[model samples]
Target: MRREFAILAILGSLLLAGCSQLERLTLIRPSAQHRGYTQIAPRYDFSGKHGRDTGDAAMLLAAGSMFFQRGQLDEAEEQARKALKAQPGSGDANTLLGLIADARGDAAGAGLLFRSVADAAPANGVYANNYGAWLCANGRAAESLDWFDRAMADPAYPTPVRALANAGDCARKAGQPVRAEASWRAALALDATHPQALAGMAAMAFAQGEYLEARAFVERWLAVAPDEPAALQLAMQVEEKRGDNVAASRYRSRLQAISPGPTTAPRTQ
Candidate 1:
């Protein structure tokens, strides 16, 4: 289990080419409860001799996104590469490939690819999301905000909740917990059970010495994601803070049994 919580689960957003193909990702392949995604018509204005190729690439990229969500990396890569081969300027294909590069431990290559797509499609919500995420990952969280705003500016952009959650997460990471909570609250108003927003609320409460509030948030999060390690950690800490030695000990023991170490919550994929 990857214990690290991330605001942006990368590869940006995918444009929908067909209804059935896109619905699979929204319903069957959600990464988490807060993982609602949007699939819309291609942002690329395919035209001229390459119009068919660009359209084909869009379709292929959508297929690739499903595979990517399913953790079928090779198949996803094949689809993405085919899309790129069909239309070299396809931002969709580039975002997929860029995420693949990041997963493969080639952050430099991922940065270059994400930057290229972002530069070419400044107004594209998908590229903006991707580039914002890339910037956040590279210690530029402050700068990431502009791109995230750019993404949300597209009225047609689906999943504003995810963008809000990303903003909250980035703000939290940047040591602005109050601002983070405000963003999370906004997300919660839209989606009450959004896991990221709930977890963030729990974290903020915990850091501020509000143990019971943190515990409440933790319980809510666990109801949605029962086996999440970070939630478990939060639970144990809150219990300990509340003077429930037995509950804390039990949670700690459970954490020790399930994870590599009870205390070391290292970020992972």
Candidate 2:
């Protein structure tokens, strides 16, 4: 009886230890519930399976978006092309192709593709927003703002805060600091814990030499995304600028540890 009791106690303790370790692992992992952004791309549901072409262009476009998100640019492009072939004026297909092109560093091609889609479906808030973001990234701030406004005006738009964030980025890049601040504040009003808006505000504050404000925003970002490299780098810069040498050094060490090493030099001729 004594041996049996001892064995049961050991098993119970081992189970409890396993549970504790599992809890710790779950805490450290990124959770979908906490993430504000949608999944990079979602899978498509094609009712007809592999080869049926019953006018399911939307499914093809969605499949392309999923492929693009998974970093399979070639497959994404193929799917997008098939979608376009099935429906010549498919805004979603063109948008997916544009995204794939953009991801593959073909900016000009992406611009052309996005422009065509936006022209075809002027009322599609998603297309307008995506095109606007592309324009903002390409330094066409004025044009981007126009598209953002168009997107925001659409009552059917699901993610207005995202469009507002893009508009804020355009305003910031265009040197309209006051407007940028207002747009970012509006985005925060929509989604108080929006990471992109917070990060943008932090960057603006840092540019103005406001290290404390920048640090606060960066801390918020870290709270949401502890391992984000860009946020980590910015936090280190802020700490260094604020004369927190010890903190800065710690961050620098972390950055060095996480960053990839430089490539070796090639042999001379």
**Winning candidate number (lDDT):** 1
What is the overall TM-score of model 1 with all chains considered together?
Answer: 0.71
Error of 1 at 131 (Å): 1.2
- lDDT measured at residue 48 in model 2 versus the true structure, 0 to 100: 33
Among these predicted structures, which one has the highest TM-score?
2
lDDT of 2 by residue, 160-226 (tens): 8877876787788777888888988899899977666777788888888899998998788777766
Give lDDT for model 2: 0.62
The runs of at least 3 residues in candidate 1 whose Cα sits more than 4 Å from the true structure, single-residue gaps closed, are 1-55, 62-78, 253-257, 260-269
**Global lDDT of each model?**
0.63, 0.62
Over 140-173, each residue of candidate 1 has an lDDT whose tens digit, in order, gives: 7787777778877866456767767777777766
Full-model lDDT, candidate 1 = 0.63
- TM-scores of all predicted structures: 0.71, 0.73
Provide the lDDT at 132 for model 2. 78
RMSD of each: 9.7, 15.9
Clashes of 1: 0
